[model samples]
Target chain A: MTSFGNEPLFLGIDGGGSKCRAVLYRKDSGIIGEGLAGPANPVQGLERAQDAVLACASAALSDAGLSQSQLGHLIVGAGLAGVNAPRTRAAMLSWQHPFAQFYLTTDLHIASLGAHDGTDGAVIITGTGSSGFSQCAGQQRFLGGHGFPLGDKAGGAWLGLAAVQAALLALDNLGPATSLSQAVLAKTHSQDSTALMDQFCGQPSAPYGQLAALVFDEAAKGDAVAKAIVADGAGYLSNMVLQLTELGPIKVAFIGGLGGIWQPWLSDAAKARITPALQGPEVGAVIYAQQRYTGEHAP
Target chain B: MTSFGNEPLFLGIDGGGSKCRAVLYRKDSGIIGEGLAGPANPVQGLERAQDAVLACASAALSDAGLSQSQLGHLIVGAGLAGVNAPRTRAAMLSWQHPFAQFYLTTDLHIASLGAHDGTDGAVIITGTGSSGFSQCAGQQRFLGGHGFPLGDKAGGAWLGLAAVQAALLALDNLGPATSLSQAVLAKTHSQDSTALMDQFCGQPSAPYGQLAALVFDEAAKGDAVAKAIVADGAGYLSNMVLQLTELGPIKVAFIGGLGGIWQPWLSDAAKARITPALQGPEVGAVIYAQQRYTGEHAP
Candidate 1:
């Protein structure tokens, strides 16, 4: 575990909309330290994202009992949330950094890397948003990452919205009453459908998306409406997987906050094919750095 | 068409988000004049809406060869877009106007009134939003009508969004490439899925909803993806109508800009039950005023 041999250090940063996390590691010593900070999604705010990145990296170095002078020995990889936005990604890449070398890519790409140990595989993300990413023989393909209310059919936001719609319909006597609807009605603090519509129509997609977990929980208890939503979500995911498999017979992984909830509802074929990730996206970011820069064999 | 008899005049106004229309009528002369003005949706701007309403009314008066002072002889009925919003309705009702009497109701309510001739029937409004409203033996039952992105499943915005999603998937080689996708890509000025997503995700629901007509047009041309989207939209509409009919067997009328677009795709049962509106929402407004303010029988 000694670093006196001038061993090279690696840093991986996973910067999402809500928070940023960094991992510092070495081949022999393994993970030496980790740091976390607020959102570092450059599309939201480049300055804020940069600040989070610097703070997390510095904190990680401090936890590893290192100083700014030691930055020269570290190579960094950042898998960021908004790296798909060209302007944001370009701006982020041009910023001055303390690391010896830096590689930047999307959070989805790194998640795929970590899930398959930097090999050819696919990962379906079904948290607040829904998307699929796959890498096969160095060629990458993306699917279904559209944001809430438009796409992300099986994502948290979509589930929550469906729950609210079901509740409203039940209240209107257009659909059967279910616990999921009742729960959503209560959660939105509306006594009736009209009140809920007035309130819900004014809010953004995030709050409804936050209610997706509640929908899943209610479905697990056998609420018919909830089950229907879950089934629909699972069907969308299955379609994504089926579409991805057409490229090649690649192993697939499920990732994101809502990942586990979708498993029970997935098709038997998808169930047999889906595999757990080897590690988190941060480790994937580190692995990406190692592969793209260090030329070191996967650990 | 002479006003020499000093017969009372009626003005029916349909004020929506994009435009305001008014028709001036006399008991003996029928509709004497019509006028159009800018949007008067109070939810968007109370002042602007008030202006549009007033301007349209004034223009109608002028077209009818009447003067502003003649407003004292006129009764007004306004079927407005945001009359369902309590604040907007209340504010509009409280405004000072020259009309001898004023009746305010939702555009949907007026549309229903016009479709059913103020009888026991139903109307499904499918444009930017989708909703079913029925009056059965004086008991009003409202279904769907959830605004864009959350509820309006079969509406324009929903169709456009589904089209975009299909286009992106097709571009990704996850689905069959179709004319709908190519047109959408060209319309959005996007070279590929990445650019399309980057562009599409930034726009609001209105623009997407506007694209819905294109989907219907493509569906008419036998595009596979477009046909699928149309089928799905029709299915949602059918479900809405079927749910509405559970209360009672009644004729249903479809209204809105995209209203007629759905007719060919409706189920045979729905087609059998569907009927045309005898008049427009403005006439419905006028009829509403006559029914509520005067002792006139529905005509």
Candidate 2:
């Protein structure tokens, strides 16, 4: 459990649009500490995200029983939410940490690193936000996730939005008939369809994304509409990976909230969209821990 | 123009998995008499569908003074592509007519009907093959087309049997990722990552599903480990509809090669997945011509 326990201990963090995940691992690649915390808004603002990271890091430190100053060196890998902006990117680079070294990157990069075991591969992430990223020959790239208006096509948010639309169609009599109508109505506990409209048109977008799981549940039970939602998501997501890989060779992988969530509702084609890496994103995180540690001090 | 004028008229037909639409109106609905066409299977089984009722009764026919009995009705709204066990349902229907009806169904029901009018609604056909149907509600229904192994999902012959199991992980070095992988590779151009052991893997699956587009293109794109192909198809198609609805309130329709194409693709939050009406299937064919004759009568 000590940093000097025959080998160094490294920290790998995956921070992105929605949530941030961090795991403490041995240089030899064993998990020692793991911590999960609130959503760290990296793009929108950094103050909140910094606080989240501090809280998560503190928790991990406590779990590992090591003081920050006692660590020999630390490798921090973060795939942040909105680091796409210059200001955000600069802010990430400017953050001076107590650790010896840290690397901040887009969430997709870390996710891919974790999934591919650090080789050239791609990862399609579907969650509150959705995107696909590929890293080949030690370089990174991506597709989709421009924004809710422009991208984020096949994320959980997308699923939720489809559910809302289906619910509304059932309400207006202008859409395909689906059981998703009843389920949506039940979500609000609304006695009528009119009330359902208020829920969707009534609220802003971020809140609406919360309803995606409802569609997933409905699809799990064989609702054609709901299944369509997931299927469509699979199509969009897989296409992104395909497009990203257009750059070079790819051994693809799925790594995200929606990546592993498709077990119950995955269709035959979705399973064929990307090459499943032997390890999930979490495992990717551990691999990242080892890679970053080695990369920093490769003899 | 009088019926005795002896001039052939242009006809619009929409054939889908659910229903067929035939619209024949000569610039007016007052004389618009609609005729039913049994399913037209010129594509699937070539020139005839088993269950298809190829009835061709145009609203113009009722207006035509010549009720010629020498020729039977010409049906156009059957989704042929060698549809499953054709004539199973067509044999049950009665076809009584004195004129020939030109067939016009291409599995792109809404687009052919709605696209020409400027309404852009996308359709994914999945009978024997699949296509993307787009109709911009009240604007145009432009079709992206149903390209094999790329554009379709979840229906027809390909999906039902492609990945029965072992789809979750396409373990190349790990021994056949999943049954889904084996199924896809066997049915696809490439039989899994390492090269197919069987030379005749694609025997049963002749006209590959649109999911193949993801695979074939992904392979071209270097997603050799791709297992998310199906999910991508479904998600992207759904997003296409989302984009359609984003344009405006739509007559989002789904009638094509497969009953489950849009479901898998429409998983995006931005998508507007519509459940269509149960009214006459080929009613669009009549409506197509009707809308042309009268501004009203088209979705």
**Candidate 1: how close is chain B to the reference, as a TM-score?**
0.90
Between which residue pairs do clashes occur in model 1? B130-B145, B131-B145
C-alpha lDDT (0 to 100) for residue A250 of candidate 1: 87
Question: Per-residue lDDT for A1-299 in model 1, tens only?
Answer: 23434666889999988899999988878898899999998987999998998889988888888776777777888999868768888999999887778889999889988898877788998888888888887677778776666577788878887888888767766568988878997788888877777777856667878898898889889999899889978877887887766667787899998898788899887787788988888999898898877464445
User: How many clashing residue pairs are found in candidate 2?
Assistant: 141
Identify the leading candidate in terms of DockQ.
1
DockQ of 2: 0.01
List each model's interface RMSD.
2.9, 16.0
Chain B alone: TM-score in each candidate? 0.90, 0.47
Candidates 1 onward: DockQ, in order: 0.33, 0.01
Docking class of 2: incorrect
